[model samples]
Target: MYLSQVKSNGKQYIYLCVYVGTQEYSTRKEKRVYSFGETKKALIKMKRWKRKFNEFPNELLNLGCGMENLEEWIRTIETGITKTGRIFKTNVKRAVF
Candidate 1:
């Protein structure tokens, strides 16, 4: 997602755009755009959206350390044990892959 500013007849407008999908080079890409009246309101909405979606799950970070198997990750979380014997008080959630 991104923001775009437009000027028309000396008036400024803000737009919030999301990239929805892609297509072949010969076809147009899919996107969604929302208009937010002015700079102040647009900025506030942008901040809220950022706070809502910018969070990364900690379990996802663990994937880099050889926890590529979902079942193993689930067991580790349930038993709260690691190779170093450290207990992780993790609140796991259903995450999309």
Candidate 2:
């Protein structure tokens, strides 16, 4: 996973881009991006994410932080950053619809 920053309408946004494919198909790997909000808050969360799994290998095959676990982590984030980003309640239906 890596942190990606983008600028839009004079504001900066950060995202956590995770490669969801195995190394066997490096050329055609899939990617999922989870938003971390604007620069100030996003930077703080990005640092947290890096520190969370920094020990894992490029393939994320470490015993504690395997690829599967990483995938689950991403899922929870997409469902709601409150599950991983920050502490706050979200209106799920609105977010989805």
* Model 2 per-residue lDDT tens digits across residues 1-97: 6544567897766555666677574674545445657755544443355567564445334224454555444444344444346532222222221
In model 2, the runs with Cα more than 4 Å from the true position are: 20-30, 44-97
- Quantify how close model 2 is to the true structure by its C-alpha RMSD in Å: 13.5
C-alpha RMSD by candidate, in order = 17.5, 13.5
What TM-score, over all chains together, does every model reach?
0.30, 0.34
lDDT of 2: 0.48
Writing each residue's lDDT as its tens digit, candidate 1 over 27-91 gives 53434355655544443443444455333234333434222322433344444454356663333
Which candidate should be chosen as best, given lDDT against the real structure? Answer: 2
Worst 10 residues of 1 by lDDT: 61-70
- For each candidate, the alpha-carbon lDDT, in order, equals 0.43, 0.48
